[model samples]
Target: MSTLPLFPAVIIDFLGSATAIALSFLALRYSWSLIRLQPNNFIWGFLFYFCIAMAAFSLSRGVGHIIKILLIFGNRNDIWHLLSPFSGGINTMLMISAAAVTIYYHKGLQAYKAIRSEAEKLSEANTRLSNSAEQLQMLNTHLEEMVEKRTKNLSESEKKFRNFFENSKDIIYFCDNDGDITSINTSGRNLLGLDPGTTKVNFYDLFCHDSDLLKYLDELHHNGFVSDLEMECKGKDGPTRHILLTANAIYNEKGQMIGCEGIGKDMTRLKTITEQLINHEKMASVGQMAAGVAHEINTPLGIILGYTQLLMDDFDENSEDYSNLKVVERQTRACRRIVADLLKFSRQAESFKTSLDINLIIQEVLAVTEHTLNIHGVTVLRKFDQNLPMVFGDSEKLHQVFINLFNNAQYAMVEGGKIIIITSASKEEVVITVMDSGSGIPDAIKNKIFDPFFTTKDVGKGTGLGLSVSYGIIQEHGGTISVKSPVEHPETREPMQGSAFYIRLPATGVANHENEENLYNGGNTGIR
Candidate 1:
């Protein structure tokens, strides 16, 4: 054949090969889609085999034509006859095998139809028997109606119970065996701050602490119920919820414990009030004793200081008597300072709460301590929010709190270091952090820092009342003071860590503006 004719044959060969590949892919999709319908059926096997044979035959013929074209056009005569085949080729053999499978499948299909027809006849007979049974069942219509009436009554009772359940002020909840909230009332949902749209809520996530919840669950399982058990739960707002939880296991008719039902009475506000009252009484008792002791020592301290000064006047500056007199004077002076602190602690000074800028108080404390801090080579940085709202408290008392903190930070770093004073406000509270880049308070001593008479300073250096007094002042102001050590340095971000004192004062929002205005209008309690 001419090369021109061979090109046409070559084109046809490629087209046929492409067509075969496309057909094979279509066949694969059809077979898979039908896999669930008649899995491993004989008819399915027949169709699969037929598609495979057709794909192979078409591919082989197309390949042979291409080879023939190449051999004729490229002047390569070494392998010409191998690809040529007769009418009864390998494809024909494959078709014959597929035809045989198809015949076998036809037989199987006939048997299946026969079996299905027999099953239909059997089903028809069973239907007649079922009809007779139904007629007998019609005789008990009065019994079914009576059962329905009883069910309606029970449903009404359930409805009444549910109405009370949903309307109660106390939280009520139902949980599955896995401690998952299956259903909860609006009060329970609101208190727990649960997502109203969520269907399944994990029960333990509502609590302040996880380990406490686990212990309760274990106890409930052992006793089959828990009654008036006090537990702390996280609230929707900032404060923790103190709940008196009462719960019991719910069992099915077969005595299988499936879930639990519970009620939670919120006692957070009452508990806080009780705690504050107790703290006040304790402070009162301590203060009375402090006053008595302070009065008893102050007279003697004053006498000793006066006598030491007179003795020093009588001796020369180089004499041993003058040096000894100086020791007496120094010790007497120290004693007087301690006495003064005791008196201050004893008198719960009349602090009239008024709206005052906390930042201004902090700035005043900084102004007093700025020279001392600079002398000790300690740098002071301030980051106060400009729009910080005024807090309702005594400016003098808050001023004292910051003064104590500043003095402590100054002493903490003997060598040159940085101290950062940051004041920021959240939605509910104003936070002030005094951070010092000095020797960090170790974990062991951290907890005792605010305890009275607990000092890390040398014997003659510190009486350790500074932190304790600061703590008391903050607590009295309805605020919280906490210290965390080994915090990352704000500027350097180094491992040589520092100490941070965090004071959080509750913020009374825009409404407090009107309150402050009212206070100014009502009386002049020295806004200065």
Candidate 2:
């Protein structure tokens, strides 16, 4: 094989040079167009086409050299001779330079694209941030406006509350748990007779009498509120005024107690009017009773006077008939005793006496009525304490108490029931329990049983004043009467059962002695 290759090699080198130049120009044109396009699309499409064009050009040149060597020259000499070393070197240099330039241009373009894309992204991000900032500013403005509006409403509410609190007519005061006055409104200052600058006055010092102030304050501290509490306060003139106080407690948001506020109203005028009404009612009832009693006593007195006059005028002084006249005189004396009881009831008298045995008075009253109970078939059960001490009371009045109780018990039992009278003594008091197994008192009448002119009996059968007089008598003796009705069966717990009346009396001897000492010492000076 003749190595005649210089001419062909030159020609091949020229063709490869032409092809590389064409490829370089095409790549340059494509890159220029890509640069004019949008950054994202240009960068992506340029990278894809650059890789494909490099591979296609390399493959085409390699295959074309292989085909010439195999079919036309048939040996490695033809390849070396037809494709000159300088040609290949030049072609490799051109391809390498072109590829490097393409790569360099691609890298430079990519860097430029990255810079431009970053700038665009930054521009877009700045635009979004600006929009977000504006929206946030608007939201913050709206929130601030809402907060200001709420603050204004709260201020208005506080002003209204202050107005109401300051303008209230009631005497309102705020005090600490220790009963120290913390704040006093205008009405409260006037009520307490305190000037605005006064801070030395203790509320406890205003109590008219020494009382359970500490106990009352402790109750306020524990209960947090007090309603309808009645107390007496000494005014500036040293006269006491009655007051009704209603109080409420103040607490903080954390549920911690701060202080108590109280409103007090003067009740002195109402108390005076109530006392006057009570006295008027008593006077009216007494007048009516006095008229009836006067008539009752007048008839008995007329009969006694008529019989005494007949005896005095007709009977001889020394005769047996005169002894019979003495009997008439004794009967008249008994009639006078009855009239005396009626007068005692009609007139409110300080008939209290000393040195009386209450149990003995009860026995005497029972002796007078023993025949009556026996005739009525009512069994009397006596559980009297033999050691009952003597009481300082009017013997006749004490007798009347027992007579009234016994007669009521007898009247209650129309069918003949057992009457149990129990008398027990204590260190300070005596208890008398009168239990009757009779028709129990009705519920409707039980509360009014001791009230004046209250009775369930027929009009003629009772004067309706027995229980009332008994109550008055007991009250004067410093005793109490209470009734408990076990209106239910003990086992079944059913209703409408029997009742028991309990009378409690302070034992007369010791208490009366103490009372007399107190009276002598001016301790009882306040009694009206």
Candidate 3:
């Protein structure tokens, strides 16, 4: 130790101390700048703190070296040697920790660089989204304008179609495949006898001859179009109308027949006049013989009845002669009735057309025949509609018609039975049905029952002309009278014992027919 060069050694220790202090200060300053860059980051911030501690330890070590040199100058090398190991150990540990912190800081810097690059990409994507939003807004505005323009055009088209449909002069109609009227023009409704605001009505119900209607429906079903088809239809408060209709089948997009559409030209008045001319010609020919028939038949028939009555008075009550006289007298009276019917049939009386409630008419007829009905052991059941409208016709003539029908029903029930009478009305027509429970008429004779002198009764029982006269009277009133035998009672569900006579007549408005006072002004009828 004495042989050592003290001057040179002292100079080296001071210079090393100065270098350590300066380097420590520079490293500390660099680490502080790094701490500012990533102050909250664990990897970088902890690395900077560790490096700062290492710099401080290095600064202390630099001071320790200077102290050792001072101690060597004081000849205290043992004390200097004792602290040198401590200072060296601290410096080595700080150097190793700083190296580890440096590695971690480098890894964090790489991760931060990647995150910054990703943020730049996100900014570009946001710019593209803004451009797309502007394009979509322009497209939406154009679509709204196009939709508004199309809607206006469609509305105009529909308006034009509606005008054409409503203003046409001819009657136009649309019906379903089932012959239900779906839509009809004003003229069509008027011709078909429907009031304004009629809810729903069937198409085939408008036709007169059911056979003709059935044929027409069959044709339409097969062909899907009907051309120049002439048919009769009842009109609103009017007579049966003749119409020449042309129709086409309507179809859906799938080519199925959804409905039918048609136009009808009215020919009612013309057809009626033609038919009247024919009927008048026939009547004129029949009237020529009617007078001679009355004159020729009355004289002999009166003489035979007189002589038979005289003979009947002379003979005993139980004798064969009296029985023969009774037979002759019975036939003579029947002959008289036949002549009376002929006269009435030939001469069509002037119709007293006035509105009258049909249900009231039924009650009156029932009143007149109720005693006779009780004698014959027949029960009368009346089910009449409460809202039936008044019908237009002659009340006296109508009364005669119902009386004949009721008498016929009485005759039908030979044994104790039931007679059900029903009356109902629709917007256009009034219906009356007289049903009896008795032995039904055979179908073989139904067609001929209305012919003159046709009878299903015993020799003295029926004049046969009763039904014929009834048929003629109903026709004169511009009504229909039909019969159905062996029909099931709608309500009772029993097989009706006899026959049904269904009569339909035109319904007249109460306000329009001022001359009529017979109509029930309040309600139509009640069950009795």
Best by TM-score: 1
In candidate 3, what are the lDDT values of residues 1-528, reduced to their tens digit?
368657887788789878977877787787778778868555556656776867777777778778877888899999978988997887787777778777777677788678767777888888888888888888787988888899999999998877776777677888887888888877677666688889888888788789768767776778988888888876657667778888888889998988888888888667756765665565556645665687688789899889889889999999998998898898899888777767665544456767787777777777688778889898887776666777777787788788888888887787778788887775588888888887887866766676656788898777666666676777777788888888787686766568888998877744233323443332223232
Q: Of the candidates numbered 1 and 2, which has the greater lDDT value?
A: 1
* Candidate 1 vs 2: which has more TM-score: 1
lDDT of 2 by residue, 292-326 (tens): 87667768777876778687778788888887777
Between 2 and 3, whose lDDT is larger?
A: 3
Encode model 1's per-residue lDDT on 178-255: one tens digit a residue.
889888898888887766887878777777777778777887788889888888988555446899999999999998
Clashing pairs counted in every model:
0, 2, 3
TM-score, each model? Answer: 0.46, 0.38, 0.40
What clash pairs does model 2 have? 487-497, 488-494
**Alpha carbon RMSD to native, model 1:** 32.1
